[model samples]
Target: MKRRNFLSLGSALAGSALYAGAMPGAAAAGRDRLRIGMIGTGMRGQVLLRELVRRDDVEVAALCDIEPIMLGRAVQMVTAAGKPAPATFGENGDGYAYRRMLDSGKLDGVIIATPWEWHAQMAIDAMQAKVPVGCEVVAGVSLQDHWNVLDAQLKTGTPYMLLENVCYRRDVLAVLRMVRSGLFGELVHLQGGYQHDLRAVKFNSGDPTKPYGGGVEFGAKGWSEARWRTEHSVRRNGELYPSHGIGPCAMYTNINRGNRFTRINAFASKAAGLHDYVVRNGGEDHPNARTRFQLGDIVTTTLACDNGETIILQHDTSLPRPYSLGFRVQGTRGLWMDLNRSVHVEGISKPHEWDDARVWFEKYDHPLWRKYGEQAAGAGHGGMDFFVIHAFIEALKENAPMPIDIYDAITWSAITPLSEQSIALGFHTLDFPDFTGGKWRTRKPIFAFDDRY
Candidate 1:
């Protein structure tokens, strides 16, 4: 039934009576069936949609996108999956269509994969409507938006997750198990970053005729376009996309639980990569050719945790570099380095030498992967996406708190804006906000590698 007609019927037959009949209990929620709505039918959204509907327990009840083509494709995918075609809202002028779906009372939750700017607002609105939200990464673009999301989650007590797939990576999770088991010893320092080259994607004047395409070359595509990401290259100076690297590091370091970031200082290399690319390809007369990108080719952010450990975060996408999270976990006993896929355990190995960590990865393979890795291998991003979605759905069906909760989402995303402020001010040490308000000190870790899972 449509929400409007349902509301009318409820008004005709007493409000409380209707609501009581419609709302389900914890027992019902735990029954494995979860009806969900998806917002933003872009490539990322479509990829997740394919993963989500693969489960018999999940139903894509609704879809929202600005473009009809994208919305139609999603509808077809759902119907092709032997599920009923989902209701769709494609009016892109304003995002009231998203709000309408939230108010419809048909969804158990919503998955948001909209562009970076819309992430905070969409998740906030879903939580405000008393619906759980599983959103894509970079929780917010600005620091205030980060606080906005935190406030909304706190105010509503609704489940909010960042959907950081990297945390579920097989190797990363294996390393996580080692960290928890004292294989890494007392965690002393760590480093990670989003260092993948996105120049082609950032500069790809997206085709406008196809679904998720429709942006003028070298111009902002209103709100939804490849220009949105590229525009960040022209304006921001800090870790623009930090979650991919920071999420796993935060998990391994027990951030927002036992350890909290206290302060940060950042430095940026000169902005040359993007401009140089534009000039080398498109002449000096091109719009981006002469434009001075505020974002440096390489931005390095150093953070100090309240527990006295240090973290180094690097953003090096604009330049020519191979994809690497650069995940480095160091402790009193040993270290795990992603670049070399090696580990150095003090007593287990020769003095001051690194040994292949592949052995440890195999021996300490995370329980989740040991069981489901073969199954998860079918999904995208080397199967990391599968585990991320699986974790969220499992938590939701069981009515447990999200594995990557609101505090983790906000804390990791806030690094971007904080780093920007630090870099702009001559690398001044900026104090990090305690979003947990000291609860981190007492809150036990919820994201642990369980053999039972």
Candidate 2:
């Protein structure tokens, strides 16, 4: 695709994919339309399902989940679109929804928004079935799951992506511009975290209709309440949730462009509040209580990439605070701590100390900001949700490389569990997995959504 035309496609398809380089009128077959099925109907799944249904070039042909109620809800949505309602699967049993969707010749790909643990397995299953897959990330739920998926991708010869949507955030695009344009000279250290207070949400593992917190864990195996956390407690670090904070940071460091994380060391707070709250809140207290969560409530994960630049990723969900994922990137020249407080060559510390971060950061009058700034700057998480979905679809339709790929997905997700291991140990430094076999640095950069940079 031509350079200008590539950008045009990105802005056009929004967040879906198409067969790029094909003849203009060749994308006519129903198969060319890229039929997609959704697995898992929870929070994340619902969002992706709703989002994809809006794209005219795509069709959702399957909706699957263990819970009949959720499946029914999704079916209602499909009917509302005036499209054929999806064939529901996994009404009972282990709920192999992805596999069920892949069985249909009508589906060319699947989007998995299942719990983190099932992500790898479902993705691999889809690939094996010769279906393209877009999976939710935090990397893989298990070390072995990671290995299996990578191998599967290479073997199946299908497009596989971990949806690290945060790469499309508005402020994030601004940061990328700074990096590509050399505003943040040689960004050496970056900081990010997904610190939300999920300690209070009540979940029931035996029942999918209830809150999704209790009695669920992600691993090579699917959701298991067997460990007993689901029966009566909360668990963290069991799944290593990453797709949130890690997404944007990975893009900033150019993980796909060969900047790889060389090492990481991390620590987690001792399990306290969640466990105590579970026991206090009528959760069954039993022998496994001691074994329930060795993971700390607060986990501070540090990443050191091959470029010798490190990014700090923190996940603290046990705390009872307002939802926040601090995306802080610091370079030798200028540093940005939040949405506003950016210090290029002057007044860096002043902005950091002030309240109302936007008061200092919002530069609505800036040229780049003025150009592609309004809707996104105020959209989901400052309009990032829209930007990311939009960019992904356009790139797929154009057959352009996505900014976040499997390589980025692996490294970013790997940090969570790897750092958990580090924190489990006495803060020992562990060599980060070479997801790309160490060839990451020599790769050419892909076009970022923010062309202004």
- Best-fitting candidate, scored by lDDT: 1
Which tens-of-lDDT digit does each residue in 36-88 have in candidate 2?
A: 78888765677666666766767788888886766787888777877787788
The C-alpha TM-scores of every prediction are 0.90, 0.79
Task: Judging by TM-score against the true structure, name the best candidate.
Answer: 1
Q: Candidate 1: worst 10 consecutive residues by lDDT?
A: 14-23
What TM-score number comes out for model 2? 0.79
Candidate lDDT values, in order: 0.80, 0.61
Query: What residue pairs clash in candidate 1, if any at all?
Result: 208-214
lDDT string, candidate 1, 1-453, tens digits? 221232232224321210011224644668568999999987789889988888898989999988776788888889899999998886565666899999998888899998898999999999999889999998998899999999999999898978999988889888876876677677788999989886766765456443232322444632234556778877789988888888888876667765688998899999888777778776777665677789999899998987777999899988888899999999888999999989999899889888998998999887778788787877999998888888777667867667788998999999999999998899899999999998877554444555322
Candidate 2, residue 353: CA error in Å?
Answer: 7.5
Report the C-alpha displacement of residue 93, candidate 2, in angstroms: 3.2
